[model samples]
Target: MFKLLFLVLLAASVHQARPDGRIVNGETANSMAVAPWQVSLQTSYHFCGGSLISPTHVMTAAHCYQRFGVTVHFGSVSNANSPNVFDVSTFTQHPSYSTGITTDYDYAVIKMAQSASMNSNTQDIALPDDTDYTGQTAQISGWGQLSGSGGTPTLLQVATVPIVSEDACKSQWGNLRITDRMICAGGAGTSACMGDSGGPLAIKDSSGKWVLLGNTSWGSSSCTTNTVSVWSKNANQLSWINGQMNS
Candidate 1:
């Protein structure tokens, strides 16, 4: 059911494969929390991953669906054990997505033909509302391998990191343009890596609700090292996301 294979291309010098590290089970850390039944989008065709954002919608990096026949599985933490699989019915890459830059807007939404069944183990995550994530700490989760060398973890893995400013990210990346269309977070040598892409970069809202601030984007070559994530904080994009969920 992968539909847009022609569009997804690997970024040059970008470490698209998972890294080698010890298997760390999911846990709560600051604003990061793992949702039950969240699955990683792994298939023979592509090495990237995604998260189940709702009963019918899965949030992932737009680059992950560039391959045809890519399959996604839910209800399991390990890639080998996940038997509940679904075919993507529709793929929607953000209209502004471009691969020209190092981390150009890389978010996308996938619609499955059937709705996912939610239980205590599985649930939809809340989206952030007009909240400034700058200077706030966030968490990211994924079932992908610990490092490029380690196998996919048997349980979900999560890590804590603080958000960075666009100016800081651009200064670090040098030539790349860190625009207002994106928000960055990381430092203190803790960050998300290859397998964490398209996952949630979340923060707590004023109401104590865990709202998604960023879809895991690219980062440094390693996870334990300092990393920066590009987030979507534009008002128009936030409204568009709310509209999608409500509609």
Candidate 2:
């Protein structure tokens, strides 16, 4: 069965779960009405999170892209009540993305059938620079589940977690390959759980502008477990992302 790259449901709830991840531990419902760039990727039967990087481009994890069919929804926090829906005209995943084998290079970009109209509820987020974000505080937002048996929430969820150093992440993950292209965050019960995959893991820079640093990728087998959640490093792939948009 094709699964969302990061989702791992409770063994008992497997049959009833949707392939997804959510913010666990230190999560709060987003109080504000607008997360301008936040978007939802709805497939024929399931959904994933994403971020709008431009009027015509949405950044997400490669695994979230369903070649069969996908639609992008913006301007709403409730996945079931999104008012703006756009058909995906095309998409491109990292050249190295492969299913069930590697999580490296798990990023992708989607081109909408029509450009999104910028409004108070819809806008693009800035990409990150070369500065290393280790130790920096970052925020992750998604509509993923609150618990293993708990279904995903209708309201968007947000969490703040510090970026974990590569050394510590590698030490924790042990035999698992922890590449420089990946950024580790949220351990000790706080993490990006099922359904959060493909959503932006962003940081507010010195200028107070939120810069996208990564996107939810994969994590431990359970949301309640103490594990380092891994994200696709956005800074490392900026060149590739720009090249695709410009080409």
Candidate 3:
């Protein structure tokens, strides 16, 4: 039931019997071996995507923290058998987050019941500096559906998307209220869908290190080739994130 919408305003709500599908124009199948920081979140009712920010902390969309009983699965691509499952000790979402409106401040932090074992298969992703990323190339990974009518994939999926400027993205979203706290990427045939919500939008820095840039927030319902996907800008919320993690 992930990302099965056709309208622009609905965004993609992929949380049902099925979670989400593979990335568009991506590998038929990929392994978590590449994106060790990527994570899968299991709620009492459904699944959402997430990223490992620290040994004991995960970052995802605040909207994804619906009810209690959330769990984090690490070191696996297949949703069927996530080798490592960690109970959530506590969670916190942005103070100003609200559903059905613009998702400008959609962010959340989850502390694991215990610290995750740091190894090659499970590691933390680096957060970016306070630099601009309007024209950078980023990677989006998820298990969302391949198409509106498609099924969720067994293996994790990923795709490369170009970050678009606020002016360009605003023109397409029209009145959707694009804010500086949000980053727009993926258009038309290339975008993140329902199941992909709360996942990471990461970019490689000049030093070739992956930096977390955005979090999957919302996109066109149709998952079409022309719709721009919206993400929560991580750089804009670094101070808030640090405050929560430090507290």
Candidate 4:
């Protein structure tokens, strides 16, 4: 989690539920048709978000991996419950991931103990290619918050905003480097903050299919501020993800 305390050292910029909160200016999604791949990472309560990439695997942020028990809830949009639930069979964090002001390689994958049943209500999202996403509208969803303050909704929240260019993102972030392996979206008013770590940030393809582009990692130091949120670009780690999922 990014700590306000982290401003002193490095962990200061990472996002979380306590201070980072959830979606700002988003709508409640109660149907799977909206985010069929959405996965709520919970430990008694929703702590983070994720996306189903395959029947047996999920994509999320490295920091979301926990040694404690975590229930993966999906197949529904309700923040409180879902028809699908799984105990983690594996939690694979990227080898290079670590928490810092410039959190690098923040992506990770989770393997379910049992494969998720495929249906209209429950499905996996397609992975992204290296194609440019500039100016494309990115839809990010989570079970975090509506207004910034610490409160989660009974339904999932989603915000749609255009992807920002690397240069512009770098410019806004100032000294912090915006690497090629990352993707930035949400600026000005609408953004995906809250406790949205590991949630999916996607764009509809020409066919109107949702393609997974990135996973929520960190955002501005404050959620209420109109700051750009960052994600672990999926195109940069397709090989590693496939390898891990197959293993």
Q: Pick the candidate with the highest lDDT.
A: 4
What digit string (tens of lDDT, one per residue) describes model 2 on residues 1-247? Answer: 0124543332322222122467775454454234678888888533778899999999988877689679998887677788888999888899987543346788899988889888877889988987887887888888777765567777778778788899988776643456868888877556777777788888888889888888887765556445667788988889999987776
lDDT of 4 at 10: 25
Model 1 over residues 1-247: C-alpha lDDT tens digits?
0111122223443433122112123343222125452456655632555556678887766655554576667665555566467877776777767666444556677777778787655566665566666777776666545653445544566766677766787666543445666666765655555555666666667778766776655554444354454544433276555555555
- Residue runs of model 1 more than 4 Å from their true location after superposition: 1-33, 148-151, 222-224, 231-236, 239-247
Model 4: CA > 4 A from native = 1-21
Candidate closer to the true structure by TM-score (higher is better), 1 or 4: 4
Over 4 Å off in model 2, which ranges?
Answer: 1-20, 26-34, 99-101
CA shift at 176, candidate 3, in angstroms?
A: 4.8
Q: Lowest-lDDT window of 10 residues in candidate 3? A: 13-22
The 0-to-1 C-alpha lDDT of every candidate, in the order given, reads: 0.56, 0.74, 0.74, 0.76
TM-score of each: 0.76, 0.87, 0.88, 0.90
| Candidate 2 TM-score, true structure as reference | 0.87
After superposing candidate 3 on the true structure, give the runs of residues whose Cα lies further than 4 Å from its correct spot: 1-22, 44-46
**Candidate 3: which pairs clash?**
2-14, 20-144, 20-145, 21-144, 21-145, 188-224, 188-225, 188-226, 188-227, 189-225
